[model samples]
Target: METTSKGTEDKGISRARFLAGAAALGLAGAVLPATGAQAADARAGRAGRPGRGLTRRGVVYTVGAGETPGTAWDPARMRADVRSIRHDLHANTVDVTGDGVERLTATAAEAAERDLHVWLQPTLGDVPQRDILEHLAECGRFADRLRGQGASVELSVGCEFWLFVPGIVPGETVLERIENLQNGTADPEQVQRRLTAFTAKAAAVGRSVFGGRLGYAAAQDDEVDWSLFDVVGIDYYSYHEHPADYVRELRRYLRWGKPLAITEFGTCTYAGAPQAGGMGWSVVDYDKDPPEIKGNLVRSERTQAAYLTDLLSVFESMGLYGAMAFEFLSADAPHRPDDPLHDLDMASYALTKPIRDRPDDPASPWHWEPKDAFHALSRRYARTC
Candidate 1:
């Protein structure tokens, strides 16, 4: 379960929708926690490797500029958003994920200009595998160009291929495929084999074009052959259903001796979200014309804020290479304080709430208000290092 927060509405796939089913099964009975000596070694290993983890704090930003009406992607607005990420959230790194090669690389350039480390992730869906491969080639070329200019840039080829890549999973779209996984129709063993094969080829393609760091954002279900990557990227979100010792679970990734990074980790804005983890976004009802959260999910920015600091503590204890908050902003999920049903931001994992456009006041400039999670990250990151 790769707890995705891609928010790739621009790609014709609702990121939360596709990922909801993946996190449904939960880790309660699936994976047991390491105890006794195993737990002690996990802690000992972390302590022995001093100064090896979480040297940088970061956040994820999706840029689907001009791809959709609801997506907030004005170049001027994005520049300001990047400024917020650096100055407000105090993040030293930024993971840029989305479809367009130009937009993805352009956002990386923005982060580079600000002296922030950049992770360039090209997330494409519902497209041919060849097209995806081509997209990766272009992204690598651009990332290498950034590196040539002395920018700290790494290329994450893609994420959670079991759902995004067409044939790896059972269904036609990402959502359907995930539902299949949840329904026990998809073979986990078959998915793993295909995932490894696809990742090896993707890593090779990335290395061929890019000279900097290369990796993939793996899901919890993926058994990645880490030898192909320069870094181990995992999207970590604690499952509230059955809490496992995160330190114990993460220790396995350390075996490779590569820098381990949490490429995505964050909860939604509503109550009980901290427990739901990645599936917190499942509350949204997309069938509506404008789309909004389902039923009565009470909004609680405090819940989101607490989830942030708690996970940061765990990441620090484990000493990760970096921990990027699932996202900085969700353009597709706008804030509607007056309308709870229509407050799409409630299900969003973004730190900031993008205000939906007002037909009555079209003259008002594009704007978004930072949620409490944003402040929590700022305080924690500012104190860090």
Candidate 2:
């Protein structure tokens, strides 16, 4: 997920957690060589032979998709969620992401164990290139191990590093860097050059450890050199940036002749969220005591449902490799009926609405009711090839 105005990236990971994650993955400071059998499939990174290029029908499941969710270690809860994504959503692949290597590896391993093609994505925000590279190295090694277990896996090296990596843009922080990019204060060519340099280094790092296909999830304006990546993934929001034809907009990446995937795409649950694009969550006054919706916004599951189904159809028509819905659950954002001000789920892109406790069902502590969007996606994906 991109570091938005909400400061999800600032959740700061502990050194112990990172090291524990490294040890969990058997990362003993040595990059292993790929097996001779591993080279059977080339660009698509499939098993034994080259298969259909873009077969990942999926959803992007962040360990904690929202900033508040990821660090909570709950395998039973997470595994159940993964099962739902595979069985309920009918998705063949899952683009698993989050900052902590331990959580990233744990969540991705769960997906892989469920026989879902795991897209292991490591993300760290507002860090130096060195820190990002280190995160990538850890992920690459773990992904390589996962593939070695005979699972279909890919290591998407890093994400929007130009925005996350410091010193590339003039902004001291990610928000400042983004501001420079938006205001046209940052040099386009300079940004591209530096980004390219960092990506090249990242690709080299990936190849050194991971035998599987590698990629990066680019932001809307990123000028990625696709030659270094096997799959072209974008954090594509349907009406974001007011693009005339999203299919036409997506075709720009097809020029590279690489398989494409929508790394992340989903709108909030408000009335006009379909058009708000990435800023849909801005309606909430996060600084408030209880975090209330700023305006008198009407929550519409129908709007969310229709938007998702329509976009899935659009992506299918375009013959995409895959388009991962932004998320499966937003645990921290619970649904509060008749309370729009505190109904944080209105701003969440999750297919399932989370609830703190179900009054009637004491047997199940935390229960999530599938919204119309969830079933809409399931019906669409169930019918998909």
Candidate 3:
């Protein structure tokens, strides 16, 4: 039982006009509508023309996490950060976390004040199947709040279900849990049906708020019922078999005739680390006490930069919508000094140093500063907008 909004029916040709305008401007691969009615109004602002001012280059933004008062959503900090990013990287969008919806709204308001776009990444935490329907209903209410404020959200990153399942539970156990979870609450025969209905309902909320521009973030191979989303959202962490391979995979998604967004992508760049295969595949921690016998891969700053350059080049050449870096700032989590694997923790993946106090020793991985990959991305994005 999904419903379409009135604005969607009247905006059919508007979407086409925007895509055509992007294609005409040499941005031929993917076309993403900027968020909110302001973008639409911006289109209308161009001399009362019905179909102009659309661009192929999709909006670019940084990801912000954590609940830190000033670091996460301070208006002054957001303005300064957005101003710096625009100056140094041409990124115009800020993807704020869902739990911080009020803070995000405030940040978005600041962004709007500064003439920047704000994309809210809503999080649907792990829920028992019995609560699925209720959760979705609550999501609808949240979307209504955004709409009432005259704000539009870009993507509603639904449940990170994969992380909960295979990451924690074993193989067959995971499948059984899914079945039990669904059956315990709803009709067993309608599990898939309910899931699809729920996904569509959530997406509809986004479309209602954002005038039909919406997407979801998912694992690379996660099988999402396509009826729920308008674009392909995939996360690629270690898929850099080669530069052409990246292009090939992205092109594969384009064959679906929908825009693609690389919601998460990055490499560890450390040697002797085990990489996780696709979704549902077991993870192989290279630093395990009894290391699993697998292919050894070496990651370095130079390699990271090369991989990024190739991917970005392919994205730009194909005129795909746009891509966001995995993160903006380093995680504030502290690293454990006694453990070898501590160097590979979440904090290590940051492009910048942590604000928290740590050992000043040079031998610590925390001692590593921004590598060439950071500057490479900064340079490319800075020049693009």
Please tell me which predicted candidate would have the highest lDDT against the true structure: 1
lDDT of each: 0.75, 0.71, 0.42
Q: Is candidate 1 or candidate 3 better by lDDT?
A: 1
RMSD of each: 4.2, 10.3, 13.8
Q: For candidate 3, give the lDDT of residue 213.
A: 50
Give candidate 1 regions above 4 Å deviation: 1-10, 17-53, 65-67, 70-72, 182-185, 240-244, 289-292, 357-365
Higher-lDDT candidate of 2 and 3: 2
Tens digit of per-residue lDDT, candidate 2, span 1-385? 3222111334443222222233333332212222343233222332211233337888877653333443244678888989999999898998887677877899898999999999888876666678778888997899999899998998887676775678787776655665676557888668767878988998899889999898888876566678898988788765743333765566666766787888888888989988866556666665576667778899999988988877776676666787888778766667888677888889888888977665223232466889999899888778754
User: How do all models score by TM-score?
Assistant: 0.87, 0.81, 0.59
Which runs of model 3 end up more than 4 angstroms from their true locations?
1-80, 127-153, 157-194, 272-299, 333-348, 358-371
Clash total of candidate 1: 1
**142 Cα displacement, candidate 1 (Å):** 1.0
lDDT of 1 by residue, 257-350 (tens): 8988889889899888877765677676665665657777899999889888787877787677888998887766678888888887898888
Q: Summarize candidate 3's per-residue lDDT along 110-202 as a digit string, tens digits.
A: 555554454555443333433433443454455455556665445543543432212222222323333334335324334334445556666
Candidate 3 pairs with clashing backbones: 89-382, 269-299
